[model samples]
Target chain A: MSAFKEFSKGIYAENPVFKQALGLCPTLAVSNSVENGLGMGLAATFVLVCSNVIISLIRKSVPPKIRIPIYIVVIATFVTMIDLSMAGFFPALHKSLGIFVPLIVVNCIILGRAEAYAGKNNAGLSFLDGLGMGIGFTLALMLLGVIRELLGNGSLFGLPMLGAHFEPVLIMILPPGAFLTIGFVLGFFNWLENRRQNN
Target chain B: MKDILKLSSILMLITTIAATALAAVYSVTKPRIELKKQEALNAAKSVALPGADLNAIYDVKGNDKVLYYSGYMDTTKSNLVGYAFLTSGRGYSSDIESIVGVDSTGNIIGIQVLSQTETPGLGTRIEEIRYGESLTWVQKQFIGKSAKNLAVDKDGGEIQSITGATISSRAVTNSIVAGYEDLLKQLKETN
Candidate 1:
């Protein structure tokens, strides 16, 4: 029945990257750069919102037996659109995101939302749910990107922030760095969530 | 029985419609995708080896552990600039690929990373920063250095290894050494 709270839950309670852990592949891959993470997050948001709204409108007609395959077909269609548009315009981000763009078809966040919320909720709520989750996903990705870029490259968005005194941690830019940073951030988020619950 | 048959037919109809729509989208985007790939290749070549006036390029087959690209450069003024070689060597986490511009006398002119999948902070020094905060080291080490002493100074060579990424540093040096030798051999037999 509530609207604003539905949106807010996505940021903290149901954070796709850290809490729900949906779409882990791109969250890990594109988090290498703030630009990459932000780009991927926005593109994913487009797909999630569009698919959720449409699915919610047609939920009753889509028979339960064939709903899973139908949801995939819908998601894959939107992903292909993002792929073509990115390749045409933003070739650099397209290259960075690479195969992960197409792989969005299988991202649990979109499919899970479609099956759960979109299938039951009204179209308005479904749209809000998608938007909220998307912004949450984007925020988490940017947070990771900023940390990784600052520590690894000793820069934020390719501009030197710390100057000569900073010793860039070599491992922060590697694959291991992604894992370690995400793990630490996840732990921190969990700690914050627990503390919030206690309060 | 008639009702069940009608329901099955309806399912088939939905599947067909969805398939048709998906196929239409693919057909529309396929050519654009191909053109984008070609443009990206040209851009990468231009940045890696400046002003090559690149002709056709090829990925050399059956080589040992290196991704190689050797191609001819067609000059504008009725002259040739010899072959350009893009070869790979070992780096911190993966093999480092370098694009080399060479003249007829086998002297190295300029080199840059065509692409690298190295460790972000540590091994990325191969693209070492020359002046600014850019990755300048990797490209600069090739300056004035010959294919003769491509190995790092530790291995009785001239080039210095990156401070923390010695293995990655040496990996790149070894790749360059071997890559030059291989490319040189190819250039000689063909020319």
Candidate 2:
């Protein structure tokens, strides 16, 4: 596949959350609200983009024996930058994101892109791949957030669309709800892809 | 020999860089974090006491420390109203932070939860309209009553616990009770 095709495919055709099932920690954790999911998704994107560029630049020097460690350090450093910016500028968002921000260093999407694409591709290609992948991840998270907030909260972003007495589904906002919703969404996407192939 | 030296030097450089970066980030963000926390405390206090003028506020112990915001009535001028205290306890899932208002008479006027991460639709009822906003059912149990009554009604106290959220109800009550007992004793000596 062309570099652009590989990158854009992640957007929805092979979304990390709904399709490939990658980078799930923040996907499930911060997705309680669109605001939180979007925040975390962007942070992950920045780290993914920076890590991809640096990894591609230094791919030759990364001894195969220590390549994993090198990629980790690059990703970790960028994650720290996002963490610091959030803490300094958006304290509330920082508090909500909390430990998940630091945990981005190990997100498979970042490491997977670095090791697979960045290791083999030119700097330009790796950057595009990362950007595309990040956008895909972010869009998935926003979708999850919208559905969860609307169902559980009886509103969107704390705004009530339903009447005051509209009792929200208590189960929709709980931990089990996250697992169930994501599972059903994944299955539906797979069914759609399968039907298209059969045709 | 040269290879070993190069590897060691690179590793050392990475460690130093990482430590310096983390330290710098902490230094810049620490103040903003603290200020945001203080602003939250002020907001909580204003909600607890609608008309009183706040004097000062600060934290004690740890992240779990009790936050105290003292204020004086505009009319009495010198009379000290009870201190609005932030307290918490280890609930079944997450720690609960609540602000309990105490009048000078050692009576609890009201209480409100600042923030929490408990089970949504379940323990989150602490912030629900009936329990948090209307506060008539839950918050009323604390009003006019002293710390002595801070227990589940099943435990032979006046507090009416939520049907399904008993643990969370008990968690807030116990924290308020313990905090009041300790603060009341300290206030006795000062008076």
lDDT of 2 by residue, A20-86 (tens): 7998878888887778889988998899888899889988876676678777877888888788788
Model-by-model DockQ, in order: 0.30, 0.37
Docking class of 1: acceptable
TM-score of 2: 0.84
- How does the DockQ of candidate 2 come out? 0.37
* TM-score values for chain B across all models: 0.66, 0.76
Global fold similarity of model 1 (TM-score): 0.79
Count clashing pairs, candidate 1: 13
**C-alpha lDDT of residue A9 in model 1:** 79
Encode model 1's per-residue lDDT on A9-111: one tens digit a residue: 7877888888888878878887877887899889989999989998899888877877787778778778888887787677757865778899889889999
Which prediction has the highest lDDT against the true structure? 2
How many backbone clashes are present in model 2? 0
Single out the weakest 10-residue window by summed lDDT for candidate 2 chain B: B54-63
Candidate 1 chain A has its poorest 10 consecutive residues by lDDT at A88-97
Per residue, candidate 1 scores C-alpha lDDT tens digits across B1-191 of 97668656756776676667767877787778778867766666655445556664444544564344544455333554434566777655556776676555666666676556565556766775733644478666775567656778788778888777788788777776677787877755555
